[model samples]
Target: MANSSQKKIAHENTKILLALRKGFIWVNAFYIFYRIIYQWNTFELKLALGYLVSAGISILLYTQINTMGKPRYNSKGELADAGEDLTQEGLVQYAFDIIYVTWFVHVTSAFWPKMWWFYLSIPLYAGWKVWQLVVKPMLSRSGAGAASDAASESTEGTKSRRREKMENRAEKGPQVRYR
Candidate 1:
């Protein structure tokens, strides 16, 4: 019963994530079209190329998140484990959201310099994401072995009551009883 409840929760969460993903894609598409149709005269070659590249990236990420969020099934038709957590993909989508907003502000700031500050957030957020998703994992992987060994050593000195009881039972051996 608990398992079914958990599955229900997971299913709901997936639906929400998928809805957000679709919304992001639609907004991005709208922005791209808006720029092309409304601001075509202001476009530089470099900015146009960048938009194309960004569009391609958005398509790739959308497919990747879809693949990751899909649940697998066994041959017996039972639901197997869902693929990678959607929350992580949602974070990636959020990063793209920031980038899109920054890009819009950047383009608009050509007419009004005061909005220039908003674009600064792009590098700051990107750097933070890099630190979190890439640098932290690499650092942890390099130190994980030693860290785990030290953790095990520390934990060994403090057994839980359950562990102590199990050890005591093992040391006592089985007792024979008369009927």
Candidate 2:
């Protein structure tokens, strides 16, 4: 009976977390569309730079907020708990918020509508998401694998070197390389 009740609690929590994540994601997606449509221009490069700055700030703040709740969210998230799943969704919201705010700043103050390639925003945002969330993690894992391989190779080299020294000592001679 106790186990059943605990499971129910966990399940309910997971559902809530999932819902929060979905809601945050929806907000992010909406903002992406809003920014692109509202600020269509040819000078997308400049716009992208501005967006990047805002994104940087937003990401920093977002990380700080999430980390502040690390004890609760990180562990729960790993266990597939509800509040934990919101972490990613929150990150997405943070990123889109950056872009939206930057767009707002540009349009209201420094924006020139004729300069941006607003059409590119859709693809750019999609690519950024893939690169940041998926591709980068994959690449980082690959890098770690490479590092492990290098470490293994160096360890083998050390073992072989020690064996060579022992063999040379056993043979009554200086090391000789025979072709």
Candidate 3:
């Protein structure tokens, strides 16, 4: 059926994306280690500071994403099913991915200084994520709280029939009959 074929395609896409993500992570780790271990004496202060800033941003964003309770990767290191959802968490992860790729480019640019422009994107993307994830939510909550207070005032005197029935049932407790 069409449903099964769709699922197969989705699984294949997941596998490909997961492999690419893992590959990038490993490559970045290896490059960073190589630079730090072998080229420490040649490293510029700017490059070291860039690495520290990137690492700090990465850790903070990762913790924020993790606390949202969505499992992005499974125990086998594959993408979790919910990872494909087009929800807020997914959007945040996508933004993180952008910063990640930019950070990689910034790292590589240590030798080719011409690519230094990529480093600018790291802070820009992070600022966008902060606006989307933090500031916007706080603004929305304040507006929603005022609206909810007004709505509660308007509905203060009435209980839905279903609520009334539920209350009555609670008052009666449990009933048992034997035949």
Instruction: Specify the highest-TM-score model's number.
Output: 1
Leading candidate by lDDT:
1
On residues 1-179, what C-alpha lDDT tens digit does candidate 2 reach at each position?
Answer: 53454345456545644454564465445544555565455436766565566546645655554443322324445333223333345655555455455444444433344334453555687799899999999999999999989998878756677878888798886768899
Clashing pairs in 1: none
Weakest 10 consecutive residues, lDDT, candidate 2?
Answer: 78-87
lDDT for 11 in candidate 2 is: 61
Q: What C-alpha lDDT values do all the predictions have?
A: 0.66, 0.54, 0.64
Candidate 2 residue pairs in backbone clash: 17-82, 41-116, 41-117, 42-115, 42-116, 43-115, 43-116
lDDT value for candidate 2?
0.54
TM-score of each: 0.48, 0.28, 0.42
Say which prediction, candidate 1 or candidate 3, comes out ahead on lDDT.
Answer: 1
Q: What are the runs in model 2 whose C-alpha is more than 4 Å off?
A: 1-27, 37-43, 73-179
What's the CA RMSD for each of the models?
9.4, 14.9, 10.9
Give lDDT for model 1: 0.66
Model 1 poorest ten-residue lDDT run: 106-115
Residue-wise lDDT of candidate 1 within 1-179, one digit each (tens)?
A: 64584466458547856775766666666655666666778756766665566556655666666666676667997667666555555665674575466556545644544554665676787899899999999999879978988888988878789978999999999979899
